[model samples]
Target: MKPGTFLKSTALLDGTFFERSVIFIVEYNDKGAMGFVINNPFPRKLNELEEFKHIIPFPLYLGGPVDQEHLYFVHRRPDLIEGGTPVDAGILLGGDFKAAVKHIDEHTLTGNDIRIFIGYCGWDDGELDAEIAEGSWEVLEGGMLL
Candidate 1:
């Protein structure tokens, strides 16, 4: 599916890591696919972290089951953060974290301005297509979240 789209886990994924998950497609091309789960939030907020304590508090979501130690984010404020890659119309994936935090601290942004996630979901070429064909996910359009 295209970036900025969504993948809703089907019944076939019940009881698995993706069960009832709603993922936001951040990258999807011939190389592979990558995204973050937008709905399955972890029990923490960004402000709880010592490094980001001065920033706005925002719920952190479990992006996926991979690279649990890493952080990722999606936002629409490309003008505030450099190196942001466009995911879809008016939506972008990733950028300079420090700049983003600075913007937040200056009241230029807020929790509602971005969505942060931990880890991410990935698939090798053709793997995601197979899963889709197997009824593992249902592609959907971006709602307000994107």
Candidate 2:
């Protein structure tokens, strides 16, 4: 629906990889909906990557079935990470990457305050509504599970 809302896969997704997945919505509007799987962690840590091999270890998650070539992130430490768009009362979507890494290196930002993803989930205009109508997902809010 809107940012800060979470979409949880229902039994309808039992036969797919999205079964039991929980997605954190970062952007949503008439254009479409976009979010990242809060669960579904990847096998490798962020530092294992070639470009960030020197940074401190951070868990990487499989956001969704969309474009996985690029990396994305969400965080809560706006005071430490600037330029991010607020998703909820305490959450934010995207911001200064260099500053984030620098803070992580400086021990100011920990994994608890951030989540990295290889890709992101997306839905075209009205596509998500169709899925919801089909009972593929259950909406959750304020950190509560459905």
Predicted model with the maximum lDDT: 2
Q: Write the per-residue lDDT of candidate 2 for residues 115-139, one digit (tens) a residue.
A: 8889899999899889989999998
TM-score of model 2 relative to the true fold?
0.93
Which lDDT tens digits does candidate 1 get at residues 1-120? 678888899999999999999988888889999989999888988889888887767678899998989889888898888998888877778899889878877878666777888899
What are the lDDT scores of the predictions, listed in order?
0.85, 0.86
Scanning candidate 2 in windows of ten residues, the lowest lDDT window is: 137-146
Reference-based TM-score of each model: 0.92, 0.93
How close to the true structure is residue 120 of candidate 1, measured as C-alpha lDDT?
95
